[model samples]
Target: MGWLDRLLGRRRPRPIPPPLWQQTVARLPFLQWLPAADLARLQSLSEAFLAAKQFSGAAGLEVDDAMGVHIAAQGCLPILNLGLEWYDDWVEIIVYPDEFVVPRQEMDPDGVVHEYDEVAAGQAWDGGPLILSWQDSQMAGDGYNVVIHEFAHKLDMINGAPDGLPPLHPGMDREAWVAALDGAYDDFLARVERAEARGEEALEQLPIDPYGAEHPGEFFAVVSESFFEQPQVVAAEYPALYAQLALFYRQDPLARAQAAGSSRSR
Candidate 1:
């Protein structure tokens, strides 16, 4: 219902892309280091996302204007370079004031124990509704943001399988992504187990985020949070992982954080 859109007799934008300023805001922290051209591209994509979707906070948390801005800002964060196109498949976003415990009952492999645990907030079903708890929306200790973690899962689900992999762009090798992530996943598991065994208080520390070792899928999601929020930590601690993610995401967030750090010192 825009003037130029009306002039062209267009209806509903026909999935037109987002604009540069929007993308920049979506990648707020990363914007500190993006080159002008790349920043503009991100901005454009964000613009299109705002134009295309209707965001609403659910439950007791009213989706007010400020809430809309916050949710849109975080929702689009995962797709800054990728654009908001992947998110088009889903329509609704539900937000809770704090972590919503999701209960699940599953049978173990041996078929003996039925176990259940209350886990933090999460996104669910493909293109369904992205569930989040604003309490953990901000950076947690070691910089784990639940909003980013769950949203990353949704992005991975774009290709119809949340196997810890999202659709890669052309010229990128799928096998490389697999190998790199697989190696890092194994290493992290071993490291965590060893730390627990040795009872090394310092060894018990997590490189990216301890939650990352929960599973391959969780590893990917957790690492992604570090890649964006605390890239320097991710890079210094997991260099190879950082490099591979750089190839996959087509962005150097760690470098960006370093640059931003340098500027802050001045």
Candidate 2:
């Protein structure tokens, strides 16, 4: 920032120290596939995210700067193309030592209400804090990243309830996105039903995580995680939905990963 801007109290973001940043990126292999420009942008977004949000650790866990930076790096990856303003609705991130149980209540279509405790690795509440299990967050890079999953939920909830649909940019075909996602969702559900009839082992053969078939909102999150962590699997198994996600995210992870691999060979 210039002197004049400083005089006006327009504080600039502090640069993320190289050592801290290198440590964070070293642990996240998926980030290695990002192009230099995109990697730099993700770094900037992660710094901004760290500056804007508050982090708290639960169950006797202490959230140090390293842990915070690591979490922020993964959290900011989804918005690498999209801006940080999309996450302005929430400012707090709560991390648990392990899986946490949340009390949930729901009303059935028949007008009956039910209550239960849901075990979750991560969760995002509309207009509220985003929660995660640090244990699950560390298990990223195996085609499942809870940080990305919860952040995806936040994105899905930006317009309204997260029913698997997030607000699309101008010129994006809403009908096309719906058809692709809904069609895949229905097909996956049918497959799961058939697998149940066959055996549990059959259900384990699903391309995408079986949890995705739980609901539309989860389908979006699960696929979003797969798009970043296992793009090839997602692209191959659900090309149409992958294309829709590629359009929405404005990045192609499969292409990026291939390019990264080619560069490594050189």
Candidate 3:
């Protein structure tokens, strides 16, 4: 049994076949960018994650070994250095065939309630199961990763609420974390507003996702996706925030990407 199986008192998950693992890694460029040692570590972490969580498919979809392995690989990346125990609170992962509708109700300032349906590609519930659209989960390499985005929210919720702040490490500065993310959040919100005023053309040019402006929590999740999938954009656009994330996640994706690029050039 793996460490997670022993810790959780669950049966050990079957190991991912070597050919399948290679095929899945080949399809994800960000995973391809990982150093050999880190890639091996990620595989081990993914196995533990699979052993610990239950996966169910919704809307007539079927969850297969390949699908489970793919999701586990991406989902475990953030916790690679942090450890599997960070995700011990949650046990179920629900996946839809495509974007799913969630019924939402809200009360306005005048105490009137409004109800509507919101379509989402992925969602991470507080102390509950994580949900995803299989279609969106497949779109990982270009920075719009629903798996990473939702998993990042899970990390944020580990402490209390998902308010763009996860519990910092012993040496990490909470004040600095707030300053960096808040400053970038404000700036990005302004940029998004301007893009909305100008039109869709301007919005499409944004290096980061405009949905990040929705909330600080959302910003943290969106940037976390970029941090792993497109580290160059985060490192170049928000150096301070990127540094904070590196410190929090305990991995330097930018350094890895740069090393890979230099290797390719040589």
Scored by TM-score, the top model is 3
lDDT of each: 0.67, 0.87, 0.91
Best by lDDT: 3
| Ten-residue region with minimum lDDT total, candidate 2 | 2-11
Which pairs of residues clash in candidate 2, taking residues 3 or more apart in a chain or in different chains? Answer: none
Off by over 4 Å in 3: 1-10
Q: For residues 81-150, what per-residue lDDT tens digits would candidate 1 score against the true structure?
A: 6766678787666778877667667777888767576867666667788887766664432466676788
Candidate 2 lDDT, 1-266, residue by residue in tens: 43212222323455677888888888999999998888888988887777778777888987777777788899888888889999999988888999999999999999999999999999899999999999899999988899999999999999999998999989899999999999989988898888889898988877778888899999999999999999999888889999999999988999999999999999
Q: Candidate 2 deviates by what RMSD?
A: 4.4
Candidate 3 lDDT tens digits, 1-266? 43323433555755667888898899899898789999999998888788889888899988777788889999999988999999999899999999999999999999999999999999999999999999999999998999999999999998988889998999999999999999999999999999999999999999999999999999999999999999999999999999999999999998998898888899
Instruction: Judging by lDDT, tell me the better candidate of 1 and 2.
Output: 2
Error of 2 at 142 (Å): 1.0
In candidate 2, clashing pairs total 0
lDDT of 2: 0.87
